[model samples]
Target chain A: MDELNREAESAPLIKFFTKLQPLAPAVIELCEAHTYRVKIKKNALLVCPEAVCSECLFFIIKGAVRGFILDDDKDITVWLTDENNLIGNFRNPGIPKMNYKEHMQALEDTELLVLPYDLIDQLYAKFPETNVIGRKLLAIHYHISQERSILSRIPSAEARYKQFKETHPLLHFRVPVKFLASYLGMRIETLSRLRKKSKQENNLIG
Target chain B: MDELNREAESAPLIKFFTKLQPLAPAVIELCEAHTYRVKIKKNALLVCPEAVCSECLFFIIKGAVRGFILDDDKDITVWLTDENNLIGNFRNPGIPKMNYKEHMQALEDTELLVLPYDLIDQLYAKFPETNVIGRKLLAIHYHISQERSILSRIPSAEARYKQFKETHPLLHFRVPVKFLASYLGMRIETLSRLRKKSKQENNLIG
Candidate 1:
């Protein structure tokens, strides 16, 4: 990427980190030095099932990615990431376990900042502040995972869909309905029916 | 607690931290100064629904605690922690959101080292090495949570139970069967049936 283009691409990520916690100039410089940018086409798989997941963490500059598992030929969506969100397999690098039985695929043409895990480790060793940032990021991720686990047990498909919509309004427009439905642990038919009913209700309100 | 008893109790926790990554004497001293011990009786709730969760991270010394959510009188177990594992709310202190719609209950009489979040923050600010330890701990937690999420999607109850048993042999003996069944997202009857079948198979092998 060219200088101006690179600057534009990194601006959102810089803003994201600063918002999480103020990053020192040195930390920012470390991030800039260690991170690289990539663009993926829609439907491209970022991480594949049974493969060693890349040790790099990704910050989405634009577009969306979805994580899904194939169960007896059925694709079940596990998670979705949108602009300004980070996505990566958080498994310990030391463990020789097979990569998770899930694939991360781009839902749209996407731009990402890839920060390799080795560089992150280096940052932790060289800059203590990065470790603080790392903790904050992981805490947020853990909180979200816990919330998703709780929501998965809600027992009502419609309620689950509504909660998903409320929590991820941007994703509603960015992700296909089928992926969203599966992500919410519901049938595509049920999601369609709910969408139609919701549209009618909105029309009546209007 | 008496000084001698306190010292004995904290030794395990100090060992746990040192094992995660070496802690300087000053850092260990900081932890010792900031942490306190708690004894929870079996069946007592450590955290309650809609309540502000204590701003303390808990290191399990002995016994078990299970995190569960009540849905229309049905208690669904989300997670279980055993000896040497750490548990914490990890919710942003500034966010007034009720600390998750879940409660953590002691499954057995439990001993814990409670490190207040503020003290942890101070440690991170003062001791850079603590930040590295914090990140490692969170990374492990994040990995486990992701694994659990993946495991929950398994279609067969027996398979899930088998995986659970393999992964948490100690918990199988320590936690009640009902909680285990709930944690596995299976009916108690099914869990019972699976257990009997597995026992019979083991007898055959013997």
Candidate 2:
């Protein structure tokens, strides 16, 4: 984490600074200088529920983050955004009642690119480069969510886990089993059994 | 439908072109003067799999369209972008496997604001307003997909329908019962029963 994200912490936009996308050099420098980098230790709260969502976007420069809701006394993991992906709440539908999302939490110690939601809105209003990246990122997120829905529809637990592993090999490696289980819409025990079955199959094949 | 959407068939952006979010006058005029109107008969296909996605976007000036894929011999409605919501596949992901979506079809005879995808991308690259709206539109779509995930997680069918009705009342009225049932992760019979129960409960309360 330290090696991958050393100067990444000093200039939060450093991860994106060297890269050429839709943003201009001056604007990129300005962002690199202005944006803040913050660290959250494992199990730390990044964004609490009903907190007005002041800064609605984040990036995992290093480590991982979890988005979950407390429904019927169960903490359900909704999304696990890491690496270059953006994490945020839905600004439309005007928020929801019974909003218990503990959005943006550190699954491991994490470095973040924190931008004010309104400023990002302004950037989208001001920059075309940002807009292309923004749309593509949203497209990526939409694809992930849709795949999860498709997985949930499939009845077999092993099949669901297999699909998830095939779709997100990085997630299975980086994230904890519990988080992976929930994200796949399955119970921990079911995931455990599936993993064991999969291991045996691999061993036999080998 | 005709009375409710007088401009639907003729104006491509009538549904979501807000004065509050206006484009440059020159751009707006360019759009209005050159933009062709599309009136698709019921079940008309807008874009199909294996076809290059050249259509920039269609604003439902009137009527409805569904974006879906055939998965395991079933048509899965991934999106139902209605009036005021933009629809197009500017970036279709198909590197691993080519076909992802089957086609977007007019649920009824529809009027659409037709902007070629290339023109919008070019304009979006040059203009801030186009980029802002494009990103904003993607944000909404992403949010809806997340909401759909949350709805699917509800253990009870009734609770899922309640959440759907509360969050997207528009879909209940505009979308076909079958699609609504599918989106809600329930059977058509179940949704019908839920609607009936909801109506009776409302009547009693009133």
Candidate 3:
């Protein structure tokens, strides 16, 4: 596209950024220039383990994805996401080198707005306000990661399921039970049993 | 307390900030004006669950601290830190309010440089380049959290132990076996056996 599409597709992303911090017109224009939309088919790999450092961050417009690392031939789910979220290489883009340690697969047909890492670095360097957004996003992600770290170490299966359900009420039903179980650090069977028990309790309450 | 202490105590902190990015004389001066050192006695609470939002971040000059949440009367370790590390309320200081869900305690007599949240917010507002340091720090903390998330999900106790020892070689011997076991999501007994097995293997190999 020769011209910037600011009207429709970029509106949501602009909203996302402004919600974090107001952007100068110049910063907005820069972002509008570099960001573009991508639609990924269901089961497509958004980020493969062998993928080179694309060094781009994705803002989830719609659909779902999972981040996992392979261990002993098994894919261990480390992160799960849906709409209105951001995912990236996670390595600092300012650094000269990076290697992908996780694979990101679209669990459903996905739409994302891709922003190049170089643009982000440029924005931070060129605009002071942009760093507020950068800092806030990183803080949010760090807090989330810390929560997941705590969740993984939680001792009780029921507790873990409950916490997951509470935090991801929509995803609880949307995501396949197996992947959810893996993300919760439990076996599929255990999660299934917990779900059955939870459903029964909900039915009684209802 | 009346005047800025720029010479001796602040050197390590200035060095730390400069390593992230060369600070402007003004930003550097502002930092020196606000940051001061505190020494915490061993076994004392640096941050308690009921502790008010101190709104101060600690850069660990020496000793160790663990961040844990009370679950069913059990304090589950959520984070562990040592020298040259940062620990805080983990809440965005820009926010008007916060509630502490974690307790931080000094594992040994600890020294730390305290930087108030207000000064941090001011830095991001006044000096654009300071945001780089903020972004970089958050990225690092987020990456660390992500790694911990993965470590907590690793299935095998031996694998977890091996990974922890590899990553935190000094912590392996320095931290108590129980806390390390808890952090690794293994019982102390299981960790002891793993350690015994590891030592035996090393001995045979040696």
Output DockQ, candidate 1: 0.41
Q: Comparing candidate 2 with candidate 3, which one achieves the higher lDDT? A: 3
Estimate the TM-score of every prediction. 0.86, 0.79, 0.91
Q: For residues A36-90, what per-residue lDDT tens digits would candidate 3 score against the true structure?
A: 7889999898852224226788889999989888877777899888888889776
Better of 1 and 3 by DockQ: 3
Across the candidates, what are chain A's individual TM-scores?
A: 0.87, 0.78, 0.90
User: How are the candidates ranked when ordered by TM-score, highest leading?
Assistant: 3, 1, 2
Instruction: Quote model 1's iRMS.
Output: 3.2
List the candidate numbers ranked by DockQ, top first: 3, 1, 2
The two-chain DockQ for each candidate, comma-separated, is 0.41, 0.36, 0.52
The best candidate by lDDT is 3
Of candidate 1 chain B, the 10-residue stretch with the lowest lDDT total is B91-100
After the best TM-score superposition of candidate 2, give how far the Cα of residue A116 lies from its true spot, in angstroms: 4.0
Could you give candidate 2's per-residue lDDT for residues A77-98 as a string of tens digits?
7767677656766465223433
CAPRI level of candidate 3? medium
Q: What is the lDDT of residue A98 in candidate 2?
A: 30
Candidate 3, residue B3: how far the Cα is off, in Å: 6.9
Can you tell me which runs of candidate 3 are displaced by over 4 Å?
A: A1-6, A48-53, A93-100, B1-5, B48-53, B93-100
TM-score of chain A of 2: 0.78
